[model samples]
Each structure stands twice: as structure tokens, then as C-alpha cells.
Target: MTMQHPAFAKGHVAVVTGAASGIGLAAAREFARLGLCVVLADLEGDRLEAACQEVRALAAGGEADVVAIATDVSRPDQVESLERAVIQRFGRVHILMNNAGIQPGSSLFGPQANWDSVLAVNLMGVIYGTRTFGPNMMSHKDPALIINTGSKQGITTPPGDPAYNVSKAGVKAFTEALQHELRNTQGCRVTAHLLIPGFVYTALTANGRTEKPAGAWTPEQTVEFMMRSIERGDFYILCPDNDVDRATDERRIAWAAGDIIENRPPLSRWHPDHADAARDFIAKRD
Candidate 1:
């Protein structure tokens, strides 16, 4: 199948969740730069406004359009309101970026609230966004895309933050399933993509960091990579950072797969006896 261009036409509408900061904000800005009508949605009202203003300023003297909506992605009512706001403002949505997420670092047997909140936003948010906007995009004959932001932690199943990991894992699985179903649908024009980003310093990880770490990539860089992947018709938009390359990421992911394929203990990569083997596996030249 031929891949579509990354450029958003002058009147096309793009909806982005978690647009207050990080990759979501970067994508919104890039969409506006491409002359698309951009809808920025986030839980933080002030930050959302600021991001929308920045996008508008960047589009000044251009035909790009921008709107900001304060939304809690976990709440179905709020997500519905976001869709209404977008349609009321732009008449149609051509792109949907399911990027709203939160990382609550709690163990599997830890507090229930953390798991609830993380799953509600990370997993349910993507579900709601797709369910709400997917049919509209499908009815339109024009090309449309749904980008779901997942995580490397989700695919690798690391030791810490089981709640966050599970939520992202669900996103990965759901996006893949959604894409398969969409491709098989007789007249569907909507496509789904899983965006797996590597270590990037953002508000989610801003507990005490004053400067970006060496291994991290900027939100702009991540968005740039995402746009390129979309143009390439990549369903799994796995991104690498300053410290890790695609090869390293592939090895890590393969090791994770081996855990299940070989029926080892959960997260055997972090097991004391398996540490050396895991390291060797990750460092092995292909």
C-alpha cells in the first residue's frame, strides 16, 4: 500500500490529547505548522492554554488554526465533550493523537488508586478516543490516522512501575488489534499506529531533574520521528533516544519476548542469576 504524506492540509483538523506538554504538545505544534486546525486537550487548564497560545503564535500570519480544551481523558463525558468541541470548532477531524497518559509508579500489589488512575487514562483514554472519533473518520473518504502513544516499558515489562507498564502494554495490544480490524474493514479509511517512545524527560518524569539527561530526546525530536514514521506507513513507531539505538531497543524487546516464549519467571531480565545473560543478550551483535 502507498503511504500518505505527513503534511496536514490547510483545513484538516487534528485532535491531540495530553497536549499540555511533551510529545502531545510537540505534535500539536507541528500539526498547526502544517496548516491543520489543531485541537489541544489536557487536564491542566493553564498549561493547555499556554500550549495553544504558543501554537497559535507559531502559526501567526499563516492559515493554521488552533483550539484548546481542558479535558480529563479518563472521563467518558469529558472525552465526549472534547469531541463535541472539536467538531463545533473545525467541523471535522482528520487526525486523532491518543497521547494522554500518566505514570503512577506502583508495584502490582501496591495501592489500588495508582493502578486505577493509570489504567483509566493510559488504556481507557485511548479506547474512548478511538471509539468516539473513529467512526467519524471512517465515514470520511479522506485519509485519516490515529496515533496511540505507548511506551518502551510496556513492551519490555521492566521491574519497577508495574501499573504503568501494564497500562502501556494494554495500549500496545489494543492499538495493534485496532489497526488489524481497521485494515480489514471493507471501506474504512482510518488507520491506527502505536507510538513507542524511549526515555524522554518530561513533566511525567520531572520529579527533580533540572536538566535533560544525556540519553533523553526532546519532545520536538520525538514528534519529528513520529511524523517520519507516519509517512513511512509504520504501524509500530518505535523511537530511539540519545543513549539507545534501534538495535539496542530491538534486543531488549526480543529479550522480553524470550521471557514469555521460554516460560521464565516474570521479568527474568532483572533476575539476579539472569542479569549477566540479559546483559550479554542486549550487547550481542546481530
Candidate 2:
């Protein structure tokens, strides 16, 4: 399905980080289909080239434009290079998607490298993308958008990878502040949005799976939901999986916040004392 945005017309440029795979790649294809010039950026050079070729092939008979750039989103220099490349090719960027992320499984008190790597890509990458392209979009009078990919793990604080959770949590908070500031900024046409995806089957979670799991959605499905959210001018593009719904997500987030609100022990959901309570809460909410 095509994304229906009045502001996103032919000749508009879109920059998507992590475009080599998953939601970023899906979004890139969608943007290209909508006649937007798409710049696909990723650290994997071969995959980035292949993804760009796919986009170009899809746009062969259309007016859509596509390009690929190898970039390490964790580094400011690489992000800057991507920005310059887009400006040189498309003149200006209309959509900036900070979607590059990595999940390094680690406990709360585990190795520091896990925390550093996850934060660098998931959190710092979003900050760099916004800092690099946001100002340019602000200078233009045309409408622009910034989409940051966050995860439900960040909001609900599930007990698996604390590094990934913290990084995505930072993304959620940062995107919120970005939207607030952008709306208040004088003459700023660029708008910020937070993309919260449910369980999506992608390379990040492939693990040699031949087909998508029953509870997980494909990247394309997630992007379709995201597009609908964008058309509705939603700030928090919270997605729902086949096994989960909006009500479930809301209750999970509320429960997480309650841990702090009620001054419960850390990770109350995993606490032996609160295990039964958490299970009952989830079951009742579901």
C-alpha cells in the first residue's frame, strides 16, 4: 500500500537509516513507490547496494528516484557524509528516518560494551540524524518529517536485554522532546515522530527462520501501519502485533510506570513476589 501524505509528493527526498534491512528497507521501498527520492543508508556495503538496486528496479517505470550510501550511523562523520550526499543528489531532504538499531542481549549488570554499542546505534544515531538533517529541513519552507524507530521493550521494560531497552527508551524520550521543540520553533516546517514497532520479523530477529512466526508481523506490515499513522499526523506511531493490541500495550506501559510510581522493587514484573501479580495483570488486561 502507498503512503498517502499530502506533503509527500514527487521530487521530495527521503533519507532512511538502516535501509539495508527490516523496517527501514520497507519504508524506503514505500517512499520510492510514492514517487519520493529515497536515499538508503546502512553500514553493510553489499546489502546497502543490493537494497538500492531493488528500489531502483521497483522505480524503473516510475518517477521515483533511489540511491544507496554505506554509512555507520554510530559515527557523526558518516552521518554527515550521508547528509551531504543527499543534498548533492536531491537538493534537500524532506523526510529523515532514524531507523538504524542493534539488539545486543545483556543483563542489567553485564558488560559495558553491550551498553555502549546499543546506545551508540539506537540512541546516539537518532540524535546524530536529527542534528544533521533537522536544521536543513528547518531552513526550508516546505513540510518535512523525522521518524525515529523505538521498541515496546523500551516502554514496557521487559526483562531480556537491558542495553537494548535503555537505548530505545532514550529514543522514545528524545523523540517526544524533539516533537515538542519542533512544534514550538518559529518557521520550523519539520515535524518529529516516534515509531514504536511490535514484534516484527526481520534480519535482526531472523535467527534462520524460514517464515515469519505466528505472533510476529513482517517489516512491510509494520511500515504499512506506520504510513497510516503518518497520514493521521500521529506523534507516537505505536504498532500492534498479531498477538497484541493497543489495550495490551497501554496496560503494559502503565504497569511499567507504576513500578516507579508505587516505588516497587526494580523490575517488579520479574520479582518472585510480584510474578503472580504481573501474570494476573497481564491476563486480565489481555
Residue pairs in clash, model 1: none
TM-score of each candidate?
A: 0.95, 0.94
Each candidate: what lDDT? 0.88, 0.88
lDDT of 2 by residue, 1-286 (tens): 5446755787788899999999999999988888788889998668888899888877633434888888899999999998998888788999999999998578878899888999999999999999999888989878899999999888887788889988999999999999999999998888888999998999998778979999999999999999899988899999999999888888777777888998988778889988788767866842
Q: For residue 267, what is the lDDT in candidate 2?
A: 79
> Per-residue error at 39 for model 2, in Å?
0.2
lDDT of 1 by residue, 44-95 (tens): 6688888888988766434347878889999999999989888887778889
Global local distance difference test of model 2: 0.88
Alpha carbon lDDT at 77, candidate 2: 95
Worst 10 residues of 2 by lDDT: 56-65
